[model samples]
Target: MNQVIRNTALSAAISLSLLGTARADDAKDIDTVVVTANRSAVPADEVLASVTVIERSDIEASQAPDLLSLLARQAGMDLVRTGGPGQTNTLFLRGGIASHTLVLIDGIRVNSANQGNFDFAHLPLSQIERIEIVRGPRAALWGSDAIGGVIHIFTRDPSAGYIEARAGSYGLGGLNAGFGTAHVAIGAGFETQRGFSATNPAAGPGSYDPDNDGYTNRNLSLRVHGDVGTQHVALTGLITDADVEFDIGETAAINRELGIVLWGEINDRWSHSITLGHNSEDLNTPDFDSHFGSERSTLDWVNTFTLNADNTLNLGANWAHETGFSESSTEVSFDEGRRNLAVFASWRGHFGTQTFELSARRDDNSQFDGATTGNAAWGLDVNDSLRVRASWGQGFRAPNFNELYYPGFFGFFAGNPDLRPERSISQEIGVDWLATLSQRVSVSLYRTRVRDLIAFTSPTFGAENVNRAAIDGAELDYHFEHGAFRLDGNATWQDARNALTDLPLLRRPDRKLSLSGSYRFSNDAALGLDASAYSSRPDIGGDLPGYARFDLRGSLPLTAGWTLEARIENVFDREYQLLEGYNTPGRSGVVNLRWNGK
Candidate 1:
């Protein structure tokens, strides 16, 4: 693992140096982006953090069905799943525990209060406008569950008209359409996938047939936006339904979710947004003689006020209710509720040649014993090409209902009403270099020390959640574009160990790397290639072998408004497993046809 990390780092350094020299002669002019990484929009090059932005065009070109699959290919990140589709998928950032990472949809927390993690598989790709990933400690800005990093998903607000229909392998079919006028806009999309039974635990030898076990998922969404006199108002609603069955066993599950969001600009300096959502999951397993279900409803509101051109203030509050009933033979019921409130403010401005940012937040929760959390961050741009950032914060998570009350083999588990929230403190520093107009490179180093980390231990029928570990890592990213071709690469090396045992964390890889290049043959044709590698993963009780995979994609414009797209994944047919007892799909091909009304 040490050798691999050293080699990759050396290679990245060499590449960056070479690209810097070549960039001076053939550089193209492009606009820099301003991101809200510190609760305010600042020049991307001036931020002392490592960040990656995936634009809408990049998402469309990837041809992925969901955000999980798309982000899995990114460097410094690892994705694990138990099966081909509809299975639980987890994301690991910078070698942190899956639960340590935070996911946000339009600034609304998406992590489940009961599950302890977010299911990235359920997020629809059609509704996404862009994604901004900050690959390091961001707890100072986001508060809790951000000990590792933060991934913010932004949904699309139609600015143009488009419609598309596609069908392919695995009984997959989809319809995506949207329209936007000067004053108003509306859009909707849907997708279905017939999943196979490759990972059925109860399946016999021949029962592993990929076509036998079938699963289907459906999603629908609607978005509307218009101006209310001098104020801009927008509303978005989405509904998703998924059903899956295992062919070898009489087990099935169904999930449904509905979400609505409202946001608007109340004048130039004031704005507010509110979101309401509900989700339900029902499962039936004759093999285990268990039938269970759960439902959750959430309401969140945020208000933003510009105290001036250089200072901003934000206030947010949320309430959630979770209730469910389960039955095996006799009937048993359960009910749980949680509420959270947070207030935060930030300031950003320039003092001569130096730019600075500062932010602080406080959170209060009502569940598993009420606790208050706070966070703060500060950053400075020393010069046009150098910046420094540091942050410290506290974050916590409450115990879930299942962990507190559930029936076990030996006895009935007891709920611990006195449980405490898990907490962590994090710090990071980074440097950004724009060697030339066409070449940019960034490196960031971060470390996080956690206390009362959540975990399940033996010796009792009840839960024992504890945290005792530290995670440290470094991230390197480079981007170069010249003429009709572009190249981008990113790599990360992380070390997460038990504070007492000094043992590596389970399921977290020590190294990750990704590289991609794209070239435009002409005004109507383009080709792209991507590759990724992972190392230092621990198997059930030992180390697992590492592997790499490659993918190729191309596009051809056929006519004025028509185009054809093709993609080949796992071109070498590499055999690897991201989840134990589950097999990944072999080589596959997909072709799509698209049209632009504009």
Candidate 2:
């Protein structure tokens, strides 16, 4: 076991740029373009990575209240939260820690540099156009924070005007509208929910409390684009303000994001895209009298050169600046800042039935020395219906602000100035089988090793990089669409162990399975059901029992250009806990009315 762990660690740092054999292809063949898979648009069928695309139609059909609820059903994905809706949430993908995943909104990074994670609870689905998730390491192309995967969100570009309103149990309600022309569009929405007690643990004299934890939010989004001469220019904006009541405190928060993109063809073989973006988040908790804030700005320029019909090359450079501050009390406050610059190059080519991609990157950080990493991936199309892919990649994560500079303001926890960045190597192989015109199946097996994992020591001490983990897992997913019936399902099993103590990782389940199916009627109506089951998972000092939950949804046409939709969550009313002391929602539901003006 010791040797196995050591070998895995070595695999992660291997210098690799093995340009494999195969011809290159674009998204034209599959009609589905995935950018996160390679930092450029590539057909999903030709990419050597595992990917999942959720389009606008899928979101509306799923009736998912938030991003977390929709993503939890995907294979190789898991969520750990402290309470019900509007609470703190963390995502673990492909057995990697929360910080290992990178999130992007319209090609701009959105995770907080100080905290190394994103808040998935508050992102309004009404503003989203699509989501493309590329699973596995791609730091070689994306630069840092890609040990597990990347999720890229595209905001809606609505050209057709529409209005929607929803209301249901727990005081759930919301309204959204979008107006647009051929080259410009604007959207806005507001939502609120009378939540349940975030936590139900027994209380003893200020130790714990149980009360209704409610949440409310308002948001606005806009998109504009037009052609100037031979070039294209676009702008986007998203802003959200929310007030939430947790188990113990009340918080008012606001988030803002803005970006611009420029695209054009310099010549017949060369095309370029430049993006500039900014994101900011501020929050204040009245009960606790605390405040936290973060801001990040980014600039990127990418040039794509079509070497030939069967070959392509991509060159890109990026700059990012981040600043943040946090204060739990007047006596405890800290502010931090950092910046990074990076350049990368990639080549995609193929030989007959096999395809290959080679990528490399160099990143320089203000707080740390420069680092260079690269990877190589290969793919084989055995026939018209089968494809096989395998890849090895390297990734790293810089220490977050709390890990490097926090002064232990709250108490019993301090930062280590000398902490080093965590590093990882990931490997995976998968098979995609198009069994029929209406059905498909995919299976992937992967192993990842993360070193220099930072762990916080107890008893009034500081953090240290004294932990390592070896994560091995398998995922199986299937989808079928025939006539008016659509069914999709996936199952996952993992063995995540601490390399030093040889114990299972905390709060990560060993087995999970989920399935969703829907049927459409002739009257332009539909009905869908979703169910999930999980095995027991380990907690800080104990284990959380396994449980299952079910949900149902339906839609119906009301009148010309009008529709009605409804859903029931937790149909079985199962009582379960994602965290030791938190509470999960019981039976709940919502109904919506919408109108489309074409």
True-structure RMSD, every candidate: 8.8, 7.3
- Candidate 1 TM-score, true structure as reference: 0.84
Predicted structure with the largest TM-score when compared to the true one:
2
lDDT of 2 by residue, 255-328 (tens): 88898876656777777777888999888996887788889998888887778877889898999998888787
Model 1 spans > 4 angstroms off:
1-36, 137-143, 167-171, 179-197, 200-213, 246-309, 315-330, 409-415
lDDT on C-alpha atoms for all candidate structures: 0.63, 0.81
Tens digits of per-residue lDDT, candidate 1, 289-324, equal 777666667676656666655555665565667655
C-alpha root-mean-square deviation, candidate 1: 8.8
TM-score: model 2 vs. ground truth: 0.93
